[model samples]
Target: MLQTEFPFTLPCGYVDARGNLHRQGTMRLATALDEIEPLQDARVRANEAYLTILVLSRVVTRLGDLHPVDVRVIEGLFSADLAYLQRLYVQINEVGTTLFETQCPRCGLRFSLDLTEGGDINDASAGL
Candidate 1:
């Protein structure tokens, strides 16, 4: 079965009006409508960058104690958290998996690296 939702922890997290920090969240795979509807949103029409906010709001089903996360919540997120989610969105939707296959040149050993842990292919020391 295809995985439709992915869980994540924000690096900086969202701080609610009550001053509570929400770090954990779940983002479901976006539907065609999820991508299309946002394009028609006035906010996105005004500022193309706002598309990220709308798209994220629709796909994120839960966040910490919050359910049905919305644009207001996504807008309140720290920049780091927004960036984190954007990368995650691309990783899961575009790349299709967090596990990256790589090989050790010397030993010819193959291994899978978890991209969610901030792994970088350019950083040779990664996963060592």
Candidate 2:
């Protein structure tokens, strides 16, 4: 079955007003409206970069104890955490699968590979 939501652990996590750390969360697959409606938001209009904030707020279903993650919650996220979520969003929505860590047997180096891209895994590594 296709997965609609993904669980994640923030690298830096979001700190609430009470000094609570929210490291774990779940983000649902974004709908067309989630992507489109954010474009009309005044905040996004004022700052093109704010689009990520809005889009994330809509797709994130839960964060720690927070039930309905909103723009404020997203804005509170540390830069590292925000970047992590952004990468996660793209992986699930665009790539259709989460990245898996693999070790190169010959080189003995660790790397991540997107298995859903099809073709030979070696061919995919060539482009990396």
Candidate 3:
């Protein structure tokens, strides 16, 4: 979360019997909601990318966004919440079509998962 509050102080131009200007500091609070436009835009873009993947995978054909089929596809793979899925989508977009290396826990063979637009499986022997 981001803090959006700031404070300011100003001296009063009027003087008392002592001929001294009075100074006071004022406190105010501003919510980040007013500055969330860019974050909201980014979230919308992430959702769009997730929906595109759903469409490509035939999870939904006609809807502008995810449908029951898409939900089913997601549920089939991971039982995660919408926020988690959105974050995952954003991370995947950031990774952007590269071969990421990982070792198989079961066989101890090093493999690479291509983070491409379409999932591509490469053999561990490829050494990519």
Estimated TM-score for each candidate:
0.77, 0.77, 0.24
Positional deviation of residue 55's Cα in model 2 after best superposition, in angstroms? 0.4
Give candidate 1's error at residue 9 in angstroms: 0.6
Query: How would you encode candidate 1's per-residue C-alpha lDDT over 65-100 as one tens digit per residue?
Result: 999998999999999989978877776688546653
Model 1 residue pairs with clashes: none
Clashes of each: 0, 0, 0
The reply for model 1, stretches above 4 Å from the true place, is 95-128
Q: What is the lDDT of every predicted structure here?
A: 0.81, 0.80, 0.36
- lDDT tens per residue, model 3, 16-106: 3455442221112212342343344554467744443342223122122223224344333322323333332333333243654445557
- Tens-place lDDT digits, model 2, residues 1-128: 77788777676788899999987789999899999998998988899999999999999999999989988999988888898788778877985454643455577554565556463344324544
Which scores better on lDDT, 1 or 3?
1
Instruction: Arrange candidates by lDDT, descending.
Output: 1, 2, 3
Residue-level error in angstroms, candidate 1, position 2: 0.9
